[model samples]
Structures are given as structure tokens and as C-alpha cells.
Target: MQKLFSLTLFLFTFSLSQAQNKFGNPEVDPVQIQKTYEQWSVYQNKNIMLSRDFTALDVSSKEITKEVFLDQLANGSFIPIRLKSDASVYYYKLFKIQPKTDTSIKATINQIGFDAYKNYKMEGTVFPKFSFKDLDGNLVTNESMKGKIIVIKCWYIHCTPCIKEFPQVNKLVEEYKDRKDIIFISLAEDSPEELKTFLARKPLSYAVIPDMKEYMNEALQLNSFPTHFILNKKGLISKVLPNFESLEVALAKESKF
Candidate 1:
């Protein structure tokens, strides 16, 4: 939800400006834009009002209603906005809208630019050594993962994009269920109780580790959610991906080696 609010700020900045419309030359209603901006500003950093709190049009001059926007975001039908931040303010860049006709604007949930990570040059580097217990009290350690392909996912319960990819991730787990050399793990920032409740509702196939915010932030130096890391048999990171499809491709290539 914090990620959603950050994205809302980015979108608001764009909508409130008088800059030319990036999607064609659609004439946007300035009066309505100002009204929507003021309404949203009241809730800035206070609440999540992304769905239907205020009425605003997309770059295509189409009304961005609640249902249509939420559906598109959930179905992975919208382009994700990439974000970067400094000590004071957050910055974001809009990706090239696909089909050149889609007007809906959406931001990546809990996603930060690669440069945001302390270990940005992740590939070919040895993953940090650590030991942690999963929900079932199974001790997982760096040494234990040696001589195998390890797939790790970093996410939390409230991340929309993270939840949206659960089915795809589960399929990957099922696909490799019989493989002895591959292991899938997920590091979540939520507490054990929150994770237990959420997992009961929507199960993830990965070995779930709870209360890993310190490990994720201090050890992993990650500022993004829904990030992935694939390590080879030597415990060296072979791939770092932002989406499931790319992780699948990387896994396919690594499994052969």
C-alpha cells in the first residue's frame, strides 16, 4: 500500500502540470484537473485513494474510472511506471505505452529502479551469507543452498503486483517440484501472523520466510518489492529480474548448466 501511495504522488504531479499531453493532442479540462488535484492533495500520504477518490482523465482524454483501472492493473494489462528516489523526493518515469492506443496510466507497485538497490550489479556476484527460519521452522542458510539453483522472491502482502503474480510463481514451483537441484524461496517483510492469515487466503508455493525486513533492507539492500534473484550452483547470482517471465527464461537457461 505504501508503494501505491508513492505512485499516486507521481501520477498527481503529472496530472496537475499544464504540460502538453504525451498521448496525442487531447484537450484536457484544466478546471476539472485542478479540482481533482486539490481533492487528491488532501489525501496525499494520508490514505490510499488511487481507485476512485478523485475523477481524472488519462492521457487519451478518457475518464479513468475505478473499476476499469483496477481491473487493468490486476490483469497486468497496464504498463508499469519505473521510480527513482533521492534523500528528499521521489522521481518516476513513465514507460512507453503499448499498442499506442491504451490510455490508462498505472505505476509499478513497490518497484524502484535498479540503481536504487545497493547491490545493483547483482549478476555474477555472490549472494550475501545469511541464516533464517521459514514459517515451518526450517533453517535455511547460504551454505545449505550451495550446489543448487536457488530462486528467491522479495515481496510483501499488500503489494498488488506481487500478489498478481502468485499464480504464475506457483506454476513455476509446480513445474520444478520434481527437480532436486532447484529450490524456490520467498522472503516477506510481513510478520508471521500477517503472513499466516494472508497465505491462508492465497497460498504461495515458495518456502515462506516472515519478518525479513531487516535482512531485505540491510543485507540485501533492496528498495523494491516483487524483485527476484536466481543463483547458480556456485552460489553466484546468475540473474536478477523484475518480472516472472524473465525469471522463467533465466531458470530454463540455468537448469541446463
Candidate 2:
């Protein structure tokens, strides 16, 4: 059995007006969301008002309702948005809707949900050119990144696994800086000065781009933290690795193309 309830939309800023939409969270962006939605009057609305898609990356094949899960995203910070269903689930069984093209948020959800709801390996065509400021605060370019296998780890100072990977990633950068074949990056949303004392002592050999979360996130299709997108010699996104090392080895191997 499934239930469809009204959705309470929330938006989180990810970039300047120019930043890319990496999270696939189109509704979360005020610039691209509805200031108002038709609120539900009762759990049982004998009349359907509108239809929208709900999405999440699932390991569990259970069917939770829309109202049930939206409340969780609002109150239970411990749980990310989840769908208790799978690809086999019917669309109308989830909610009633007009054509997906009816609205902006609707369109974004459809575009993003198509990927978020499935088990996907990151191997596809994407923006190839990449650039960001290195630790010194000087503007860095993709040209400087030539001849290297770039591992752009889209992260922030607060991400745990990001900090955890620093030592090993630094080691890889140290070993390969001269080779022109490999690179490691820890891009953050904070100012370089905020990390100056930290980076001064560590002195990363590869690169560090601070306050670039929005542009880079969009530039790289970033959704998961410590989202590792590997770029090969051709400067294309050759792989998409998520979370910690526990989930990255195969991705690391595959994206090294």
C-alpha cells in the first residue's frame, strides 16, 4: 500500500547565478522553485490537486509514502529522502500528475530523479573542461591541469570522509606531481584564508580550490559529498566515485580512463 501527500519544498543555495546545477536538486534552488504549492487539506484528498515526482538513491526496496517521507526530510535530519519503491513501481501509484513538462521544478525533478532512483555507474559524457583556484589563491586553469589524471574531489571542510581522505590523497599528489599524469584536489566552499594556516603546514603538492562549491558542483555534476569525478588526459569526466574509499576503488580504477 502507498500514500501520496502534499510536499513541503525547501531550497538550499548551491552557487552564484553562474554555478552549475550539480545536485539535481532543482526544487531546492529558490531561483528555480515554486514560492507556493497547493497545500493538502486532508490525508485523503478525494480530489487530486497536482502531481510531482519524489526521488532518492535507494538500497532498500520498500514503499514509503510522499507525506511520510517529506516530514522526515524536514524533521529527521538523520534520514535523507528515500523511496521505499523501485523501478517497477508505477508512477500513478506514487502520485497523479499532468505531463512532466508542466513546471520548472517538475521538469528538474524528472531530469534528476531519472538518475537518482537507479543504480548507476558513473560513465558518461559531461562537461570536460575544468578549472579552479589552487591553494595559493591564484586562479588555476584546466591548461595547468594538462597531461594529468585529475581527481577532483568536490568537498567542503566539514565533510568527514573528505578530511579522512586528505592524507592518502596528498600522498598520491606528492608521488605524482612531477609525472604530469595524476592530480588530487580538495575543493571547498570556504575562503582560502580560512584554510591558509591549515594548508601552509600541509603544503599540498597538487591543488586546492576554495570557495568554489557552487561553480565546481555545477561544473562537475556533483551531488554526493566527497564526490570524486576523475578526468582523464582528454579532460573529460571519466568516472564518478562517491563517499569514502570503501566505495571508491572500483570507481577509481574505472574513471582512470
Candidate 3:
């Protein structure tokens, strides 16, 4: 079975040779390859600590095949991305009859979460202080944010989940659009021009701030995409929403404060 699986994989990689490299040794057991993929899935959802350097050592731990695959996937050398309406999916383009497509194969490679940092346990802590000029050059500061319920969302133009969640975020902005006590701010890693182009096609009413990746990394220690922070009236961090699904629940908790 292992020899047959290896032969199958070789034939598949041969077809995509122009696009990707062989991810594993031909002699490598198919069972081990499958295990490597499974380990990557587990790391993405749970054990991944993005605050540290993201490397093969960080991703696969002791598994050699997993490490090689993780490196190739990160560098876009082996996998091809498929964008779907519901979620962005990845497939082993070079590996034939592999686990992602075959249930019997048991090897799975899903969308990796390099920036899926969930270390924001600072709910009761004071929100980190900073100021930046919005896209319109309006100076936004923690001082200005004080005495108001500040909604801060961290996103980038290339983030699929971030883009998908924009409509709901916009609705949340509209619900409180009439109120001066509530402020909506988005901190993006994109430049002002990139944001301008994206927002032209898909408008977001929030006060969009650009070039905030450094602030996110240094101040917030965020290693993930689409993180939302809610600062209460006192400017203390009230709730931190990690993904789009947490928006409503985070808002519910914020409503009481």
C-alpha cells in the first residue's frame, strides 16, 4: 500500500512539476506523510503560538516530513489556494491521491493560520495607548478615544476572513452611526492607497487607519488576522473578539458596559 501510494504521489507531482517541487522523499511512507498533514491541521487550530518566529521548527516540532511540507506551503512552493465563498481552502497540488481529497488517504492540509494569535487575555487590563492619522489625515489618539466606547478592528486588505466580515462590521457601525459616544476604528496593515482602492469597491464607514502592523505587533502582540478590540468608556479593554463569529457576543457584553 505504501509503495502504491508513493507511486501515486510521484505521478501527481510529475504533472505539476512546472509549478511545484516534490514535497517528500519518494521512499517516505505514505502513512507518515498523512500523519504530517494531520499534525499541521492540529497546529493551526490549537498549539500554534504565532507570537514566536514561524518556522518549520515551530510548526512541525519533531516531524521531518511535516516540517518540509510546512516550509513549502508557507513559501507557496507546493500547495495551491482555492478561494471559496465560505472559506479559503488549500490543496496538495503536487501530491497525487493525497489526504486532502481522499478520505481513505487520511492526509489533510487545510488553510494554515500563521497569524491566528489568540493571546489577548487583556480584557480587564488597560488598553494600550497609541495615536495615528486616519486615511483622511484626522489625528486619532487614545485621548480622543477616552470617554467613548471605541471599537478597534485589526485587518489587512488581503485577509479573506477580514474582507468577508466587513459587511457585518459595517452594519455594526451603522447601528451606532448616529451616536457620538461610540467610535469605530479599523487599523489596517495596508497602505492608504491600497485601502482607498479596496474601500472604493467595498465601502466601510469606519474611521479607517492605515499602516498599523507595527502597532499591532508591538503594542497588542497580535499574530493573527481579524482581531477586534472593544475599549469601554473608561478606555479600559472590555472585550477582545478574535474572529467574525465573536462580534455579536462581544457587542452584547459591551452593550452592558
Candidate 4:
């Protein structure tokens, strides 16, 4: 099924970069260290070639193969966020080794810094206006959101983390359902039929709009999956949370009731 395919892709992508082996020495300044995250390829029967961004950390073995690196990471030999200084090093493991042509293999790795994503505090900034039809064919726009605390979530059916947090999001919606001034809306990246089928098996309490990816991306400039935007009654952006847990905390503090 299409839904199953989406779920599989999400899991594969999440696990793919978590298998890479990259370690930073705590004794060195983070700025002095290089190759926090990199992609690599191996050609011929020779040596592994890392991308320009990568400089190998001094590890136990310098002659280890990519497979060996992955195996060690999977076996818990290397841990994420190993070194801390001005920058925190989180090594995303190499999850795959795919042969390209005859004599080459490509590998992917991610290096995330402690401040990779700086949380945006857009409070007092005017919320942008965008329109999309909810599942019930009701038009949802900034005008519709006026005089209310608007909670808008940008999500898709295939995102595992988004689905994992759906229950908590649903609970939050249920808790504020009775309040006329608080509205929870989900702009899903799926078509209406897809959402209908998916929701039949896994239901959510928020007002869901299907096939709103275009408007969500172009109008709201939201590209991140499972992003939440909270707007106050004055239509000002109050909080922009990347996950439902943070949204829950924001809701509690800025409750409209």
C-alpha cells in the first residue's frame, strides 16, 4: 500500500544516518576539529575517500573499512554527542554501503552540532495569511484564525516521528476542543483520499487539511516536517516548536482559556 511505503521510507531515512562512525576529541576546540559530518566514497581496491568537509578523527584504527566503521557504531562502540566545547559533536552513523558501478561504494553520514537548529522566537511578529480547505470543505485562513489562539502543524503521513507524537497532539487538541478561542489545525502533505484512508486506521482530533503542501510551503514558508506554529489572538506568532512535546509546553504557558 502507499501508506506502508511512506512508513518504510521514514524508518529507512531515520536509521540511515545514525550508523556512521565519527568521533571528535574533547581535548581540542570544536572550531579546530573538522569533518563533523561528511559523505564518503571508495574507488578501486585502494582507500576510502571522504568529502572535502571531512577530516578523520584520531581513532583506534586508521585502516578500517567502511563496513567496520558501521559495525562498530552499531555495536555501540561510538556514542553520539561525544565531545562538548563551543560546539557539540553528534555523529550520525553510516547506515548504508551501496556499490556504484564496479569499483566504488558510496556512504552517507550526518554530523549534527548542538546548535544545528536555533529555535526561532518570532513572538510579536505578524502571522502570515494562508488559505486551505479543511477535510470538511471549510476554508481555513488567517481571517478564520483571528481572535483565536491558532495552532498549525505541518506534517505528512509518512513521517514516523510525526506519527509517534500524534497521540500527544491529539490529546492537546482534545483538551482545548471546548475553548472557542483555541483551534488546532493540521496541514497534511497527503491527498484527501490518502488522509481519509490513513485516518480511518489512525485518527487524530485536529482539523486536518489534505494536499496543503503547496500552500504550506509557498505561503507559510514551512518546509520542516512536524513543525508547529502557535499564534496568539492578535495573530502574532507566539511560538514555533519543532515537536509536539515543545508545543504542549508552549500551549500550557500561553493557554487562551
Candidate 5:
């Protein structure tokens, strides 16, 4: 978890799954090290919160072992994220534990929601609001996405999976372009010059919006490319579709306005 801030890291952070290190212990080692992500999977789908105060106290005087994410107690049992290494470490836990299920179905939703959290509404409270520029360089707010069911595909050209998924995404866009009840947008992390020239001749006929790096960074806590979210007519985030097939399913499932 390379945080937006902080450059120093610790190596032994993941071994302490059940221990708390609130204050500081000078005896602990201090050297730059990458945080371990092994323990993250255990708490992935469980609603958990990160506590900076608790982490500061633990690693204050010693070398930090891993990067962690913090959340309000009310945020949710678990949150979606990439392997975190930068945010301040926060002690976390699942609000409600779920029973173990078979591996086949587990893999399906883990792709949908982190740690197989699809059955539960993540956040129970917050929804995503995007602010990006339209082709004309006008700033677009989350409210601009209302009225129509909006599908914003976060992507990059180099992404293998994304390249494979483009045609299907384009097809969905073409099918719904005339409906007026829905809209499709393809967003990429690359600069307009880089993406525009490449996609100009492609079948993607929807209005391609560009320059939302800051929005994507915050909403997904990810600088990595090719992430997308689907917004329902009520302006609530209905789905986070990270791939082609999933994106199609979300579009097909939209409740007609």
C-alpha cells in the first residue's frame, strides 16, 4: 500500500495478525521495507476499519511492517482496495463474519466485490461521485451523470484484459446510445493525445471523457488503470464493473427509467 504520502516502509508488518502495538517500542527494527500483504486476504471480505492512532502507537518507535487503510467504525465491515502500502496503518476487523462457502462461487464475487463481499452492501453509507472533463474540456460533476444510467469504464490501452473487453463495451454503448435512458463513457488514465489518436478509428462510438486522474485516484484508491463504476438513475453507485463481461451484465441489468 504505497500511500499518496510517505516513502518509508517496514517489512515485518504482516506477521502480527492478532497483536496490537498502539504506543511505540524502541526495540523494534527500523529499515525501509515493503509491507506484507499476506494477512489482507484473511480480512478481505470482512467489514474492517483501519485506525491510524492505533497504528502510530504501534509503529511510532519501531520500523513499520506493512501499509494499511483506515476507516470510520461506521464505514462497513470490509472495503475494496488494491494491495495497500502507503496509507497510514490502521487496526481493522470485520463487523460481521461470514461463513465459508465453496471455492467456485467465492471466486465469482471476489472479482465483483473484494473478499467475496457482493451479498452485502459495502459502505452501507457512502457512494461514489465522479468529476472529470468532457471532450470539450468542460468539467463534469457527478450530478451530470443523473437522468441516464451511466457506465464509466476506467481503462488504459496497455491493459491486456481491457483491450480484449473493448469490443463488447463498444457494442453495449452502441445498443444503448439511442435509448436516452442510459449513457456510456470510456475513461482512461492516459493523456487525451495518447488515447484519442489510438482509439479514433475504433468502434467505440460513445463520447469518451478524459482527465479524471484525481477522481479515479480517490474513488478507487488506485493509481492503477482500467477500473470502472456504473451509476444508476437515482445517482447511487449500482455496480463496480472491472471487466468486459461484468460490464455487459451490469448494462443488461439496468432498471429502465
Candidate 6:
């Protein structure tokens, strides 16, 4: 996965007192949270602390409340934070606030909690039964996907990270072009017309299904865009990954190809 941050700490450097003065109730503004995430690369692994005023969205694109956020600090949630200096880098994990008195809190990543969360939410669970028609009018469903390894990507036309991974995902499809037992597919939130226009400029190799907002939200209950789910031969989800690199690794392991 690409590290989403630069080494320039001065850009984000701020005083705790300064943050305290500006602190306010957590607002459910997806646009503002997204803008902040884009500017700071909030999901990156870094040795830094976020100010109390920092806003973060949950997987569903909803901003977490201050009270709930503080509760989750002691409990566990899939939020962005860094682990110990020696530990393997993790982007989103169960994080605890350090130095309780400070307005700027150091996030301590809890690897075990993260693993448990993944296991409960993704691994070993059957992929929800879905029926979708691609741009070519080909119908695909869970029944059709059984007996084959499936790699599914959920994304929208305007999501920057989703668009950024197109080239690499196309390469992934090309790499397995000859494989008969595996399938690559994408569920896009845009309409077929929009997708057709976009793909004409930036092509993708996966069988693209458009206008999948309902399925992506209701069936998958996904909180983030550009999420990848790898399913085994039995249609059981083997992994839920944030990036194509991680998806590739999961695919290789599941398919043994």
C-alpha cells in the first residue's frame, strides 16, 4: 500500500492549547471530514497526534460523535492510528488516546483488536447474495460466483483513491487473464452512462456493474469507498482489504494461484 503522507511534520504541527480553544461538538459533515482526510491523509501510519478538533468519519462516511469517539478510544473501533515504533505499520485499528490530559492525543494502535474486528466483520462470513447487471447486460449473482474465487471492488466515480487504483487493479486483472477459476468485478455507484464516459478515458479490466449504491450500502454495509472483498470458492469472504496490494495478497492466498 502507498504511504499517504509526506515526511513534513510542520504542515500538521499544532499546539495542544491552540486545539483546545478551537474544540467544538463533532458535526456530521461528510464533506468536511473528507476534505480533512484528504488534506492530512488521516488514515496513514505516522508518528503524530491529532488535535481534539480533528474530525474523523466512520466506515459509513458518517462523522463519529465526540462522546462516541471518546468511548471508542477506551473500547475498540476501526479508526486511524499508528502502532508502536517497532510494530508493523497499520492504518486503521483499535486506538486508545494517550496522555488523557492533553488536547492532542497520541493514538496507540491495538493490533489484536483490529484482527478481532476483521474476523467478526469479514472473515469466514458468507458474501451477501447480490444480483447485478453489468454494462454489457450480463447478470452476475452469488449463485454464479460460487465454485470460483471472486475479487469484488466497491467504489464510486468521484472517489479519488478509487480512481487512483484503477491502473493497478487493471494490472491485477491482466495478470490473471488466463485463470478460469477466478473472477474480478467492480460495483460502481455511478450510472452506466457516467461509467461509460469515465471508462472511455480511463479503462478498467474488471467486469463493471454500475449504479450499485443500494447493494453497496444495504447488502455490504460498507463504511468506506474503494473497499475490496475477496471471496473463496464457497462465496465466503476471506478478506476485506483497503487497498489493491492487500487484495492481491489475499487473492493469491485464497486461490493458490
Model 1 sits at a Cα RMSD from the real structure of 16.0
Note the clash tally of each candidate: 0, 4, 3, 5, 15, 2
Q: Model 6 off-target regions past 4 Å?
A: 1-97, 100-120
lDDT string for model 2 (1-257, tens) is 12222221112232322232222222222222233332221211222111223332211323466444333323332123212234433222122223322354344344333333221333445434556667766765678876666677677766777777777666665545565466666677678787676667655444678887677556555666676666676666565555435224533454345
TM-score of candidate 6 relative to the true fold:
0.61
Question: Taking the tens digit of each residue's C-alpha lDDT, what string does model 6 give over 115-232?
Answer: 3244335677988888889999999998988899998899998999999999999988888889999999999999999999999999989999999998888888776778888888
Off by over 4 Å in 1: 1-120
Taking all chains together, the TM-score of candidate 3 against the true structure is 0.55
lDDT of 3 by residue, 93-129 (tens): 2233344534422222322322222333365688887
Q: Which candidate leads the pack in lDDT? A: 1
Q: Model 2, 26: alpha-carbon shift in Å?
A: 39
TM per prediction: 0.56, 0.46, 0.55, 0.54, 0.51, 0.61
Give the alpha-carbon lDDT of every model: 0.65, 0.47, 0.61, 0.59, 0.49, 0.63
lDDT of 1 by residue, 75-109 (tens): 44332221222323222222223443213222332
Residue 68's lDDT in candidate 4: 45
Best prediction by TM-score: 6
Q: Number of clashes in model 2? A: 4
Query: Which of 1 and 5 is the better model by TM-score?
Result: 1
Scanning candidate 1 in windows of ten residues, the lowest lDDT window is: 109-118
